[model samples]
Target chain A: MPFVNIRITNEGATTEQKQRLIKGVTDLLADVLGKNPKTTFVIIDEVDTDNWGIGGESVTEIRKK
Target chain B: MPFVNIRITNEGATTEQKQRLIKGVTDLLADVLGKNPKTTFVIIDEVDTDNWGIGGESVTEIRKK
Candidate 1:
């Protein structure tokens, strides 16, 4: 089974947005790819802004610098 | 852009297997769901058995225990 995990650093998203995103992702995978949603696990890990990085820089500290 | 990253704990696989796996995954996503492989990033991180865990136990140590 193919697992789709989305890890986001943004903490400002509302509950509805997260739910919609999950639903959209699941539907895209299941409906289009014909994947079994029951067996296909989707984990959304909401991480703090301080824990993520891009282009070899910390998102939090780099933004300040 | 949707990113499909596959992280595996097995380090014993050959390069061919890894290539095949990536191709299969990419084909499944692109052909079935019509995703653009150029924009849809697929990263396969091959992790050592020592770094992975399952059910709250490290894979390497748990196997010995």
Candidate 2:
């Protein structure tokens, strides 16, 4: 089973966009790795800007600066 | 920055349990790999039994037999 987890800053992605992500990721794995779509799992997590940090600063703070 | 995503079958996990998972995974990566905790990301996804499969059979179907 192949599990794919995608994390993005909570920037208001539409449901249709999320649906496309799930479908595209599943298809990509199946095409490249021969993984079964039924066995493949794709999860998307929208992280708060305050919760996600890069370079010792939260995304929220970084955006402010 | 270290990003960790944990996937488990949708068993009833307490909120406390999930909190511990987030903390433990962040700590593990920091202790083992010297990653910065401030920049570490831990996300957990619970999959439906019907969605997860192994050996060409879904977990839900396998449980029935």
Candidate 3:
């Protein structure tokens, strides 16, 4: 079983978008790694900007500049 | 750097609980994998019952039965 996790900023991603991401990632893994979709799990996480850090700074502070 | 993502059901997890999870996971990685805590990233994602699937059924449906 292959478990995939996608993390993105909470930018109001629609359910349809999430579905597409899940499907696309699953398909890609199936194509590349020969993984089975039946046992594949894709979880999408929407994180707050303040919580995401990059290069010693939070995304919130970075985006403010 | 180790990126740890913990996915759990959205069962009203408090901030302190999440923080503990983050710290614990970070420490575990450092102790076991020798990963650096400063560069390590721990992300906790709380998923809805409807979004989680198992045995071809969503967690919500499974719970209802």
DockQ of each: 0.08, 0.10, 0.15
lDDT (Cα, tens digit) per residue for candidate 2, span A1-65: 89998889888999999999999999999999999999999999887564454544456656887
- Write candidate 2's Cα lDDT for B29-62 as tens digits: 7789998887787656678999999999999999
lDDT of 3 by residue, B5-48 (tens): 78898979999999899999999999998998999999887897
Model number with the top lDDT: 3
Candidate 2 or 1, higher DockQ: 2
Docking class of 3: incorrect
List of clashing residue pairs for candidate 1: none
Off by over 4 Å in 2: A1-65
**TM-scores across all candidates?**
0.48, 0.54, 0.56
- Strongest candidate by TM-score: 3
lDDT of 3 at B22: 91
How much is the lDDT of residue B16 in candidate 2? 59
Interface quality of candidate 2 as DockQ: 0.10
Q: What share of the true interface contacts does each candidate keep?
A: 0.02, 0.10, 0.06
By DockQ rank, best first, the candidates go: 3, 2, 1
Decreasing lDDT order of the candidates:
3, 2, 1
lDDT of 1 at A6: 54
